[model samples]
Target: MSEKEIYQRVEEWLSRMTLEQKIGQMIQTERMSITPEEVKVFHIGSVLSGGGSSPGENKPADWVKMNDAFWAASVEEDEKHLPIPILYGVDAIHGHNNVLGATIFPHNIGLGCANDPELVKKIAQSTAREILATGVEWTFAPTLAVARNNQWGRTYESYSEDPEIVKSYAGAFVEGLQGDLKTDSVIACVKHWVGDGGTTYGIDQGDTDISEAELRKIHIPPYIPAIQAGTLTVMASFNSWKGDKLHGHKYLLTDVLKEELGFKGFIISDWDGCDYLNADFHQTVAQGVNAGIDLFMVSEKWKPFGESLNQHVNSGNVKPERIDDAVRRILYVKIKYGLFEKPRPSARYWSNHESFGGSAHREVAREAVRKSLVLLKNENDLLPLKRDARIIVAGKNANDRGHQCGGFTVAWQGVSDSMDEESDEPASKITTAYGADAGVQRGKIIGGTSIWEGIKAMSPKAELNINGNMADRSRHDVGIVVIGETPYAEGMGDIRQGDETIAEMATKIKGLMKVLHPYGHSLVLNELHPEDLEAIKNITNQRIPAVVVLLSGRTLIIEKELEESTAFVAAWLPGSEGQGVADLLFGVYDFKGKLSFSWQKKAGENFRKGDEPYNPLFAFGYGLSYSNNTEN
Candidate 1:
């Protein structure tokens, strides 16, 4: 349909919708909280599968069946109301990562290091296809956060700290995910609008204390390209600008994004994002609506939120014109995406089991993993190891698929093979009727090759000693130690203040003790995961040439680890395709990735492209390759 036709349809739908229906169109609920019948009765406009929230077997077919139920409910004709298709969204940020067997691509941090916009676009296209296979039409992805501080937990989600790199990748990603807004594509949401990564002390959802000029220069540039690429939605950030929360920031949400920049699509709130705006629910609804949020991702609170929004509108706290505008935007996007004309979720053009974790998608993911491995240290040219060399793979991350994928894989905070006895993190709690055991069946649970598996694939004689212990050390030619941060997301991954004790940090994170470092609150690579350093030391002490492959979300204090290793590779969260890491190690592929973020020498040190007294362990854009014969 043409632009005029889309607008005419949007206006026609806006004119007919009741106040409740319009409010429903503005609300997005989590699937677990509201039933399919509830979605129809309440006229809920959107539904989402929050991180690990899945239906009956958590398979592609299961997702299609579940979405089909919701689709049927939404379009079911009744005497009282008109039928409107509900939009189903997911955090398919990496590669439809929430589902098992789906090809998990390199996280955004790794992709940033690859520095290939075409590759990122291909990954986005594969991600969209996989998401469509599961019957989801929208994805909350291509996180445009320009992370300034490495201490932020979600640094891995950002493409780059440099806004120019982020700006370059944004349009390509949007274009890939939303190809002409057709049946095979999914709606792309460029996210956490403005300065989510520039928070104070690198705190997740903390205040971004910067001048508006600095904000535009560093943070807002990425969104311009994304908007230009015709992204259909923008998720509001959880963080505040200076002291003002973004959910209620009328100037940025309305005046800047919608009016000045000309974002035609809807603006959405993050998970319970409005609740952070005000103490009173009604006030939050009013403030959020007046601030120009087109949709509320209320999660479980959709009904109460809808009721509150209705009351706020009736009491004149929120203008009817604002409500109509919000509804119109929602309807416009729905129509533009061909949601109104499409059949049920199962009958969609791209929905099928073959596309979920297909070979072609996994191959793209493997190429991404190969391109993303940033070789930091190649002293004496220890990498490009012979395939026949006797290898000893050791460390916590060496054999763990969950740790390799990191956070936002299968679960909200991601899954881990090793769970602390005292901690009740998401990894321990998640079960999909696939299995009850967490550690033993974790590989099958998330479905990915560990670095150990990749090594064995190439060299079948390679021994897997996870703890780095060997009775006969002389048997191994080399020891490959894979180590880094375990699975964590948001506040759970934040490098706490130096003054804050582990006990205090644990209390703040609601007793999630697994994430707390026993030593101190710091970004030291060893301190956070001491066993990693121990494993590396165990191998190095035996005079074995230790090849340390660090799988982390961001640059860490790695001076101690670097000192103990012969060759060090900063493999930033290579997801599902550990063979790619092996490819670099075994000479099948050379290292191509450069440092997306500056490698910090000290813990909690803040350094960027233009910082004064700019001393880093390794500068930004640093990498080593066998072809160049470079050493760092």
Candidate 2:
């Protein structure tokens, strides 16, 4: 519809909504905290499932039923007179990541290495289809974070350190997700608004202590294309810009984003975002509304939030016009997406469809994994292993799908299917976590293939051993040690933030570096499990060639390990689809990925493109093809 038509519908809807209903439109609650009945009584505007939050069944049909309940309540109309369908959103960042059987794609960092904007758009389109199948309407994705610091926990969420790459691909992802704002597409939210990527010392939600000009130059450029692509919403950053929290930054949120950038859609607060404003709840609401946050993702605190917002509006502390403007934007987005026309979840085209985790989606994820694999080192042509060669896949990650998928799998931290219980055998020695024994068809594999299984499929006689002994290695022609960081999201993944001077911090870093020094680059000690170095040493000690398949969210200081090992490949958390890794390993596909982030030369040494003493182990865009370049 045209702007005039959309605005006219928005105005007509706004005219009928009561003050309480208008205020309700601004509050979003987590599904666990509020019910369908509460959604009707409170006239709650929207609902979200935080990471790890799902219905008891945790299936696509269950997700649809759960969302349908909230949708049913929001549009009931008996309580508040007029009905505005609730906008449901999820962190479908890499895929519809929350669903167990959904096809999991490479995270943004892996896609960044692919450097194909069109491919990235296709991935988003794939994600939208899976999300739509489950009846979800919005995705908090296409994270435009230009991660400058490798130490940042959320670095994997960024497309690149270069804003140019981020700028180039942001709109494609947005377009892919919100394709013409049709029923099959979910609204794309270009996220964490301004400078979440430029955080000081790579701390999560830390200050982006840069000048406005620098922020504009480095961080804000990506959003321009994303906005131009017709994204229906932009999520405010949890990080601060120039010492002011973005959730309440009036100039940036309202004047700059809305006025200067000409962003027509609504702005959303991060989860419990307004709580950071100040101790006074009333003042926080006033400032957030005045600063132009159309929707407050209060999660569980919507009750008090709604009450406070109403009091602020009635007392004239917050102008009703601000409320009207916020409501107008909310209704505008709802109408533009045709949510009013197709309010019920089950009525949507893809709703209750059995196509959630189809083979086609998995094939695309496999392709992403195949394209994103960076062959950092290949000595004596150790890769593309002879199909008949006896192989021993060692290390915890060799057969662990949960570790391969990383965080944001079935659970908040992720769950693993343990093919190798203690009673299973020597090959399955590594233990899996969480839902290892869930009665899913493939156990915890959940439409995923482990690297060990992928390897076995090609080389049926290959041996599987987590910590292979000398006898095992002596019998095998080649040993592939798949080892890297364990699953973690947000804060858990960050290496010591600059301010962490705690005794435990010092002890842990020292212990980690001590265990990791043998592998090379210990000073920039990553959160490497103790078994990683042991596995590599166990394999390399023998005469057999050792190929290290390193899985991580970002570069680790692995200069020594790379030298000691016959070959190394950097697989940045290739989600599910272990066949992709196996495909390249066994010569079914060639390596095509290049480095998206710069690899640090040594520990305690990290630099972006512009930094001085700019030595790196491997520069960005560095990679090796299977047919050529066999040197280190």
Candidate 3:
């Protein structure tokens, strides 16, 4: 639709909405909030499920029912209210990540290594299909942060440290998800609007101290292509530019993003994003609305937020023109998505489709896994072992299915079950059903294969050892150690946020580096577990030529581990398809992935770009292949 037609339709709808309804249109409540009746009375415009937030059973059908309830209520209105449909949003960053049994594709870090825009677009399309099957219509994804620092907790969310690669991906992913915005397509929301990946010391939501010129050069280009690709919504970042919170930065959010860049879509606040504006609620609401945030993602405080916004507008703190603009942008997105014409999510034709985690989606995810593996070392070609060779696969990650998918799987922080005694399953054949409760088991990995499962399938004689304590190490011709990061997301992944100094942070990380690191629903953000080093040291001490497979979201401090290993492979958080890792390991597929971020030799080192490169352990785009060719 043209700008005039969109505004005309918006103005026609605006003519019927009261101040209370307008305020309600600005509020986005969570799923666990008040009942559907409350949604009808309040005229809530949107609903979202934060990480791990799901309906009873966390199944696709249940998701459809839950979303349908809210959507039904929003459209049920009297003559006093406007019967606008509500938009259901999710963090379907890597597939419909919130839904159980959904196909979990490799995270963006792995996709960055793949470096294929067409593949990224296909992944987004598959993700949208799964999300639509569960009745969701909007996703906060294609995070366009040009990560300049790897220590940032959300590094995996970014595609690359290079702005050009990010620029390449932003539009492809948006177009993939939005897919002509007609059928089985969801609203593509390009996120964390500006400079979230450039924080100092890789702090999460910290300040970016770069100049406006650098910001325009490095951080702003991705959004331009994404916007041009017809993204319907953009999320405001939690991070600040020059110490100013992006949620309240009118110059960037309004002048740069909307006016200067010509982004016609709406700007939505992050979860409680305006809370950082000020202590006073009304003032913060005014700042956010005036700063061009169209939707307020208020989780628990929607009622109060709506009241405050209404009061601010009534008091003239927020101008009517700003309110009209915000509402126009929001209504335009809803209209553009055809939400008004379609019924609830459960009523859509694609809802409850059989392709949520069907073979086709899983195949795509498996292909992504194969393309995401980066071989860091291959001393004397230790990999591609004969199918019948004797091998010992050790390390906590070797047999752990939950660890393979990493964070943002079934739960917010993905399942982190260790290979302990309690998890031992009978040596039964792999099961097809990884029910809602299925996770890592002793002899059988659930939901997906582990590196050990892959190796054993390729070489059935291989022994699966988790602790590396097998009595006869000399029995094995070659040992493969699968070890790396435990699952993490957001604040829990931040490496240097709270510590006063680098030494203090390193000391803290070292203290938690042992077994059973504190696990929580949210607050824990431990760095790469140190047990990989201990396991490698143990394996190499026995003179076992070790080939280490590092399963992590980002490159870590692995110089010590590198010293003892005969070969190394950077198997980034390959989600739900362990056989792909096995395929590359056993020469079923060549190592085609490259390093998206410069591999750091030290924990405190900064991220390296190709230009003005630093002395990284490995440069950006570096990777090894079985053909003995190193690509950079």
Candidate 4:
């Protein structure tokens, strides 16, 4: 339809929709947080799986079935006269991430390393197909934050450190999400409107203290491409620009992004972002509404927010025209997605089927996992492991499913037995993502062994040993200690703040050094942060020539360690591949992968909180190996 025709229909719908319903259209919720009864009662606009949020019967096919049930019940016989289908949402940040079997593409930071926008687009399009199968139409993805710090919990979610890279990929991802926004494409949200990844110290939802010119230069470029690509929505970040919270920044939200940037989609806020307002709940609602937030993600308490907003409209605090504006935007999106008429009927959704995590999608996921691997350091030709070598493997994360998957897996920000699956081929692990959880078994590398088990498997000649305690006998050839911050969610309650986690981790590394110092055997440490090299040497500063192996998500600050260590390996989020790591350690698989995100220079937390220029310990895509040490 023509733009005018679309506008006329949206306006007509807004005029007809009740204040409650119109406000409902502006809110979204989680299934657990709300109920079908509540869906009926509140007449909520949409629902989503925040982070790892999913239903109990969360298999991909079952997800389709369950969603259809909710849609059938919620959309049937509605006296409130709401829109047709209730848009379902998810954090399909990578390859329908929450859906167990769908292709879990590498995080955006890794994609940024690929530096290929076409790849980004293809991944998103693959994700769109899987998402559509499950009856989900809206995905909150392609978070185009120009990441300034790797310390940020969500840093891996961002596309680039440069705005240009993010813009090209963000637009590509939008195209992938909607398969061309001009058609009946899924909605796209180019988010955090101002600066999210630019926060100092990598803090989540923190502040950006740059000038207006710098902000526009560094952070605003990505949104331009996303808007031009015809993204359907924009989610305001919980961060701040200059000194004002992005949610409350009128100029950035209304004037610049909507007016100046020429973006036509509606604007959404992060989860309960409106709660950050200075006033009481009601006043907070009014302030956020006045500031130009279109969708609140108000959740179950949407009634209170909607009611307060309605009061604002009635009392002249929030212009009625603004309310109409928000509703019009919402209607425009629903129409664009064909939700206005098609309504994503329950029957079209496959409640149970063979195609959940089928072979087609798995091939893409395998490619993603492989390319995402970054080869940080390889020394003395110690990589791409040989077919046969007396190898010793050790570490807590080795062979652990929870560590392989990292955060936002099946559970919310913690550990779990998630990645135990057979390596049949490069097939999609749908049963895991989309829930064929019945067949999951203890992950085995077939004839190969885990670092601990591998040691025992190839004992005597191989002499593999793994334990938390130091080795009493120094007969072994080398020492390898795998340690770092354990899993944590949100405020990081699992990992003790300060040096407790880092200190213990460092101590454990030093202990290994002391044990193997006499032999002068090479030392390998998993999750070795670059900043710890000095401290490690200061622990003894002599003997036990070492190799630091990083085995965590995102990149790290690796400086002194780069020079001090004989070998360094960046096993980029290797899942069920501890044996694969051991293979590389024993010179089996060469360290083929290079750094995805930039590394910072040697420094102590160069976050741009005060006057710092956000100095990184290393540059992005910087990795060195003994075999292939040439820089990419």
Which is the leading candidate under lDDT? Answer: 1
TM-score of each: 0.94, 0.92, 0.91, 0.78
lDDT of 3: 0.79
Alpha-carbon deviation at 279 in model 2, angstroms = 2.4
Q: Specify the poorest-scoring 10-residue window by lDDT in model 1.
A: 510-519
Compared with the true structure, what per-residue lDDT tens digits does model 2 show for residues 308-403? 988988899899999999999899899998898885787788987776788888888999999998998888888889889988888778888878
Query: With candidate 2 superimposed using the best TM-score fit, by how many Å does residue 37's alpha carbon deviate from the native?
Result: 1.2
Q: How many clashing pairs in candidate 3?
A: 5
* Weakest lDDT window of 10 consecutive positions for candidate 4: 512-521
- As for lDDT, the candidate ahead, 1 or 2, is 1
By TM-score, the candidates rank as: 1, 2, 3, 4
lDDT of 3 by residue, 124-227 (tens): 99999999999889999989998887666688888899989899999999999999787868999998989999876666666777899999999999999999
Alpha-carbon lDDT, every model:
0.85, 0.80, 0.79, 0.58
Please, what are the lDDT tens digits per residue for candidate 4 over residues 1-632? 77888888887777677777777777786666776666656667777776645665456666776677667655666665553457788777666656554544555666665577776777777777777767777888778888776555666567667677787887788888887543335677777787877754444555576788888888889888888888898889877665477777789899998899887778988777777655478877887888898888865577677678878878899887888888788778877766755544345533343544555555554445444455555566445443344333334444454454455544445233422224322211122221123343232112212333333333444432223133323333343444333333332311122433333333322111001001111112223332344333432243433444555555544554456555565544443324444544554334445454556453344332223464544445565544556666
Which ranges in model 1 have alpha carbons more than 4 Å from their true place? 418-446, 471-473, 498-520
Instruction: State the displacement of the C-alpha of residue 241, model 3, in Å, after optimal TM-score superposition.
Output: 0.8
